[model samples]
Each structure stands twice: as structure tokens, then as C-alpha cells.
Target chain A: MSYLKEKILKDGVVLDGNVLKVDSFLNHQIDPVVLKEISNEFIEYFKDKEITKVMTIEASGIAPAILVASHLNIPMLFAKKTEPSTLSNEDQFSTNVHSYTKNKTSRVLVSKQYLTPDDKVLIIDDFLANGEAALGLIDLVEQAKAEVVGVGICVEKSFQPGRAKIEDKGVDIFSICRIASLENNKITFVEDEH
Target chain B: MSYLKEKILKDGVVLDGNVLKVDSFLNHQIDPVVLKEISNEFIEYFKDKEITKVMTIEASGIAPAILVASHLNIPMLFAKKTEPSTLSNEDQFSTNVHSYTKNKTSRVLVSKQYLTPDDKVLIIDDFLANGEAALGLIDLVEQAKAEVVGVGICVEKSFQPGRAKIEDKGVDIFSICRIASLENNKITFVEDEH
Candidate 1:
């Protein structure tokens, strides 16, 4: 986690309106070494959760989610934002998610064949700003009668209401780097818990 | 590579009109073990290429690309289909890509900060059906004046014109599993060279 904090400070850029762009190493352009460390931290945090599958939403979430799933030796399922024409089958579990960046609501879908009542899912993403995508993933898991073990995020804007929204569902949230504020192109980190 | 061949034969479902759905292991619900092996194979194939970066598109390609980048100890960059509002800056390399699945063409963008003329890129993707995404990625790399050493594909639909399109660029191509034909729900693989 300290490594991520240092990398964030070194490579992350804070834009106006609390947007922390870690595209240089985390999101758009990724450093596999840093990403592996982040995935290991997520595994260490949730080692006792007995997670069966790592769930995430595309496209930013897939990288970290895949790494976490690889380290956990579990399968990873990514919910698709676009309704793929090939997945025309009606046997999918889906929910509507509102994207603050895009400012629109779209239905995210996952095949029921992957998630079931016997599965314990860990939801992972790159950023936890509004938590709508995580909520939508939780909705998909619930529809399949699967248990959500927890939500793992790479970066969380603590000043935002995303944590409160996800906590309302009673799911434990763990983020590698928590931002207290991103005001005036300055990043303020919250006190580390681990 | 035989593992992928067997996996595709066992879990991949051939849908109507030559669409091979490997949602059970490749695209939707991913098998980390198989994916890791595929990444290793990519490393073995391009061991002499001195690949400085691994480039892929969003969603499916990120999983394999991240793994390949990790093994190669390099950075991975994914082209975004939608121009993120956060990245509204004009300092990006963009190109149009036609998605056969979505039946639409969209611009894929990569930040100019990632790729440069000194870098050597290895393009990775899940499938090489029509090769539009690969070509789009190649275009992005070329826009940055970077060298595309080769392209690594998990599964190549050899019956399609994707290979011809990519080969026309005079770049090397390596596919883990090549499908000679997918007619009448039967997967006939091309003879392996390695």
C-alpha cells in the first residue's frame, strides 16, 4: 500500500474537480509490477474471505481484477457495459449502472453460468468515485444469489460519497490508496489503516 | 498451445455464423491458469523481439496483455473506445476501429505520453477475427512512431481475412490457437508449426 501511495504521488496527476489521473501507471497505461503489488495487497486483505470469484466491470477494472483473480487462483468475471450481440441469450444477470464520467446509465450484464448461489464474489475496480459500478456488480451477484465477500479498489476518493453508498449495502470496502481530497490540483492522502 | 486448443474444444461454443464463444474461459469468465499459460507462450514466441511495451484494446485484451507485460517486465497500454471526458486533452493518438460484434466503428485513443519512437510494441488481443482492433492498435503505435515488433493472438479465425489484413502490413503474427474452419459448429484447427 505504501508503494502505491508513493507511486500515486510520483506519477498520479490531480485534475480539477477531484479527478486523480493515475493513467501513467494504474489505469490507462499500466505498470505490471505495480499492478502485481496492488493485487497482492488485495489478496492479503481478503485472504480469509473464501472468495470463489473476482468480479469487476470493464474496461478499467479488468486489469487489476484479473491480477487479483490470478493471485487468488480463482476465476475472474467482468461485466460488460455494452450488450454484446453474441450474448443475445436471455439467461444473463444484469443491472443498470450510472457512470459519473459518461453521465449516463447503461445496463451491465454477466452470464448466470459464471455466478451462482454457491459463489462468494469479490468486486474489484480501479477507482471508487461514485460506487455505481460496484453497486451494479453487487446487484448482478445478488440476482444470481451469490454472496459478495467485499469490494477491493485501487484508489478511493474518500471525500466522495462512494464509500458511504457502498457501505450502505453493508459490504466491507478496501482500497490501496485513499484520497482525502483532490482540491486545487493537490492530492491529500487519508491516514492508512494497514 | 495444445492446452488452449483443448480448452477451446471443451469450453468454446461455436455460435451461429462462425462466432466461437469462449465465454467459459477466455472472454467472459476467465481461467487464470490457462490465461497465464497463454501469456507464457506469448513470451516464448516473442522472446527475441525485445518488446518494450505490450499494447491491447480495452475489455478482453487487457487480461492477456497485462499478463504478457508482467512476464516481460514492461508497461501495458490499452486503447479506449470512448474518449474519456477526463482525457479531453488534444495530446492523444487516436484512430478509428470497426467492431464486428457491435456493428459499429469507433475511435480508439491512447495517450501520447505512453508510446514514443524509441519503444518497441507487441500487440496482444483475445481474438483475431477481422483484425480491426489489432490494426487500430497498430495504427496507434505507428502514430507515435513506435515499432510494432509483432502481434500475439490467443485465437485466430484463419478462415477470416484478419490474418491477411495484418500480414499485409509486413509484421509477424503468432496465434496460440488457429482455427482453420468453424463450420457447422465444428472447430478445425490449423496445423501447428511450433
Candidate 2:
């Protein structure tokens, strides 16, 4: 985690208290160098686990997931944000995800062909806030009867409830950069608890 | 391109006559191995060009753009699909794009700060169909007074008008797979002339 903890994305955007924005490395532009390191960090953190598949949501998460999955030599699954395909709901594993940033809720779908009861899933995402997207991914994993090995996140707002919510589900999390606060346009990282 | 012309995605999904679907490498799930090859192909084709940024539309193109950008050690910019941010339309280069797959037209926006007049951008994407997405991306690059070095596409339906459209804009294109026909659920690759 310290490897990424030392990194500053978008030169670390300065936003007022309680509003965190790290838009430079993702959403708008992604630095492959940082993302490459993020993938390696996730691989290093979750290397010991028997990760069968690396799962993530579409748009932002797909980039990191691809690097990690490729390095691990595992298939990367990204839940589609598009309208469910012609395949009935039974043929797909889906869940409702509410985005705190955009303030909207959309149904995310993953084909049953990809996720199954045999997968030891490692969920990855660009950022974690309120745990909405992560939870939706876990829901889809659960619906497939797959085992959730743990979740790998690039940036986590430790001040938020996302960590607790995922832990409540008995899933583990390894976040590279843990933000303790973003008040007064200053960035602070949570000291490693370990 | 012959190197990739031999690769078949999703075992070449069979659907009778003209309708082509490649949901395996991208959109739903992205095979890192294939994407890695695609990135190398792009690097090989455009290696001589001085590319400042690798640009692509969000949701699907982000994965390839990330890989290509990282391999080249350049920044990757993905146009956001979300509603334009508070950055007045004047400050953002916005365009209306119609997705034949989704059958809907929505605006895609790119911040003005990232794209600049001095940029030599290499546009990348997962597929090329009617060329609406490609054309929209080209428009955004042009709006910023940036030079479009070329377009790198993973899969292109050569039978479609996308190739003709992009070529008409005077932008070079390098597609790994050029499909000649998909009649009778059988896949055919366009024979290389050179």
C-alpha cells in the first residue's frame, strides 16, 4: 500500500473538506505509469490468494483490472453499464449500483458465462466511496455462488463507510492509497495500521 | 496485421448474415493476452509517430488506451460518457454520438485542459462500426486544434462505412482485425492487399 500511498495523482487535486476528487489519473485521464504500478501493487497484495477471476465495473475500473488480470494470467470481467442484453436476467448476474458522484443508480450486468460458482474473485476498482459500486459487484459475485477472495482498490476514502460495509460482508480489502482526510485543500494519508 | 488476423475472438461468435458481435475481448470481458498483442501491434504500427496522448471514448476503449498509453509511457485520455461537468460547454469539447448498439444518442465530453493544440493524438477503440464513435472522437481532437496522428482499432467491420469515413478525414487507421463478411454465421477476414 505504501508503494501507491507515496504517489500523488493529478498532482493530488485540492478540494475542500469532505469532497475528494482525484480526476487526473482516472475518469478523464489515466497515467499508465501509475496505473501500471497500481496493478503490480494489487498483484503483490493479492498474490497469495487463489484468484480465479479479477472483477470490476465498466468505464474506470476496467483499465486496472485489465493490467492485473493479464499479469495474473486470469480473465478480467467488467460488468456492463449498458442495458441488459437480449439474454434474460437468468442468463446474467446483475445488481443495482448507485453512483454518489453522478447521483444516479443503474443496473450493472455480468454474463453468467464469465462468473460461476468456481471463481475465486478479486474485485478491483479505481476508487471507493460509500461502497456502492463495490457492493454491487460483490452482489453479482454472490448471485453466481462464487467465492469472494477479497477486494483490491486503488484509492480508498478511509473516512467513508465503504471499508466497513465490505468487511461486514466478510470480504477482505487491500487499498493502495487510504485517504484520512481532504480538508482545506490538503491531502492526508492514513498511517499504515499494520 | 496478419499477426492479429489469425486471432479469433469469442471463437468468432456465429450469427447469420452481416451482424457482427465480438463481446469477448472487450465491452463485457477483456482478455489481457489479446489486448497485450493489440497494444504491441499499435506500438509497431505507430512507433515512428510522435504521439503525445492516446485518446479513446470511455466504457470500452479505456482498457486498450490504458495499455497502449502505458506501453508507450504517454498519458491516456478517455472521453467521459457522463453528463458534461460544470465546466461550461465553452471550456469543454462536447459532441453528440449515436451508438448503433444502444440505439441512442448522447453527448460525450472532454475537458479542454488535457487536450491542447500541440498534441499529436493516437485514437484507440474496441470496435469500428458505422464510424459514429470514431468520427465523434476525431471531432473532439480537432476542436482542441490537436493533430490526430492515427486511429488504432482492435476490430473493424470493413464492410461498414466506418473505414471509409475515417479515411476521408485524412487520419491513418490500423485495425488488427478487418472483417470482410459475416454471412451465414461464418467469420471472414479481409485479405491483405499489401
Candidate 3:
């Protein structure tokens, strides 16, 4: 996590409206070397858990989730934001996710065949700001009668309501980098490692 | 390539509209073990090439690209289909891509900081039908002044104009599985070993 935090400090730009842009490496353009290390870190963190599937929401979270799943040698499923014509209507689970950045609520869905009662799912994402996406995945998992072992995130805004909302549902949250606050165009990290 | 062709014959479902859906192992739901094999296949194919980075488009392409990048111990960068809020205007190369499935054209962008002229990029994607997405990626790579070594595709529709179009541009294409045609709701492979 120190490596990630250091990388964030070195390249992450703090813009107006509390937006910490790590696009240089993390989300937009990925550094697969650093990304593999991050994936290994997640695998080491969840080494003991029985993870059946790694579930992530699309567009941004795919890279980290894929690496994590490959590192752990588990299958990873991404919930599609835009419904493809190839998808079948009979075997799908749908939920609503509100994006504060886009100021729109969109319905996200996953194929029901991917998730089942036998699954011990680990939900992963790039950022957990309001926890809306995480909640949506959890809903889909439950709909398939699967267990959400934990939620793994690359970055979490600790000052936001995301952590509290997820914790309220009795889910264990593990984040690589936690932001304490953003003040005066400067980014601050949470002091506690946990 | 044989493994992939065999996988398609065994697990791939031929849909109504010449669509072969491998969602069970490739895109929506990934089989990590199969993906590992795919990573090895890419490594074998591009073994002698000087690949500086593995570039891919977002969503489905991320998994195979990450797998190949990890196998090669190189960094991977994927193009963003939507404009991420964290990205800065100072560090991005953008291009237009038309989606056959969506019936719309959109601009895909990658942070310019991650790529450079010295980099030899291997473009990776899940499918290569009409070659629109692959061409979009090639455009972005060229815009960054980077050399595209070649393209790696999971599945290619040989009956379509994709391979010829990409090859006419002088870019070598390597497809794991090439389908000759899909007729009578049956999948027919042209040069597939399986």
C-alpha cells in the first residue's frame, strides 16, 4: 500500500472538486507492472479467503480486477454498463448505480449464469466514493444467492460516506490507499493503515 | 491457438446473428486458467518482437491484455471509452471509434504520459470483426508517435472484412481463433486447427 500511496503522491494530481486524478497510471492508462504488484498485494491480503469469483463494475475497474483474478487464479466477471446485443434476457441480474461524476443513474447488470449459489464472491473496484457501485454488485450477488466474502478497493475516500455505508452492511472492506481529506489543493492520506 | 479454437468449438455458443459468444470464458465471465493459457499463447506468438507495452481498449480487452502484459513482465495501457473525470487535458491522445453493436461513434482516449515514441506497443483485444475498435487503438498508438508491433485478437471473423482491412494497413494480425462463417445457427471455422 505504501508503494501505491507513494505513486499517488508522485503522479496523482489534485484538481478542483476533490478529484484526485491517477490517470497517469491507475485507471485511464495502466502500468501493468505496478498493477501486477498491486494485484499481488490484494491476493496476499485475501490469500486465506475462499474467493470463488472476482466481480467488478465496468469501464475503470476491469484492469485491477482482471489482474487480481489472474494473480489469485480465479475467474473475474465484469458487470456491463452498456448492454450488449449478445446478452440474453433470461439470465441476467440488474441494479441501479448512481454516478456523482456523471450526475446520472444507470442500470448495471450481470449475467445470472456467471453468479450462482455456489459462489463465494469478492467484489473489487477502482474507487469507492459513495459505495453506490459496490452496493449494486452486492445486490446482484445476493440476487444470485451468492455470498460476498469482502469488498476490495484500490482507493477509498475515508472522509466520504462510502466506507460507513458498506460497513453498515457487515461487509469487510480492504482498500489499498485511503484518502483522509483534500485540503487547499493538497491531498492527505489516512494516518491509520487499517 | 489450438486450445482457443478447441475452446470455441466446445464452449462457444453460436448465436443467431453470426455472433459467437464466449462470455463463459472470455468477456463477461472469465476463466482465469484459460486466460493464463491465452497469456502464454500471446507470449509465444510475440516472443521475438520487441514489445515495449501492451495496449488495449477498455472493458473486455483488459483481461487478455493484462494477462499478456503480466506474462511479458511489461506495462499495459487501455483506452478509455468514456471521459474520466480524473484525466487532464494536458496528457491525453484521443481518437474516434465506431461501435457496430452500439451503432454509435465515440472518442476513445489514453493518457499521453504513459506512451511515447520509443515504445513498441502490441495491440490486444477480445474480438476483431469489422476492425473498427482495433483501428481506433492503432490510431491512438500512432498519435502518441508509438510504433504498433502487431495485433493480438482472441477471435476473428474471417468471413468479415476485418483481417483484410487491418492487413492492408501493413499491420500483422494474430488471431487465436478465426471463424470462417456462422451459417444455419452453426459455427464454422475456416483455418482453425481444431
**For model 1, how does the per-residue alpha-carbon lDDT over B1-194 read when each residue is reduced to its tens digit?**
47889999998988988999998899989999889989989999899998999999998999999999987779999999888766875879999999887789998999999999999999999999999999999999999999999999999999888989989999899999999999989999998642
Error of 3 at A168 (Å): 0.4
C-alpha local distance difference test of each model: 0.90, 0.82, 0.86
Higher TM-score: candidate 2 or 3?
Answer: 3
lDDT winner between candidates 1 and 3: 1
For model 3, residues A50-167, the per-residue Cα lDDT tens digits are: 9989999997788889888877778999999888787867778999999988899999999888899999999999999999999999999999999999999999988889989999
- The digit string of per-residue lDDT tens for model 3 on B76-194 reads 88898877776767768999998876789999988888889999999999999999999999998899888999999888888888889889989988887778888987777875431
Q: In model 3, what is the error at residue B107, expressed in angstroms?
A: 1.7
TM-score of each: 0.97, 0.93, 0.96
Poorest 10 consecutive residues by lDDT, candidate 3 chain A: A28-37
**Best DockQ goes to which candidate?**
1
Cα misplacement distance, residue B63 of candidate 1 (Å):
0.3
Error of 1 at A131 (Å): 1.1
The DockQ figures for the candidates are 0.85, 0.68, 0.78
Check candidate 3 and list the clashing pairs: none
Off by over 4 Å in 1: A192-194, B192-194
Give me the candidate number with maximum lDDT.
1
In model 2, what are the clashing residue pairs, if there are any? none
Q: Residue by residue across A51-168, what tens digits does model 2's lDDT show?
A: 9889999878988898898888788889988854434577788899997767889999988888889999999998897999999999999999999999988888888999999999
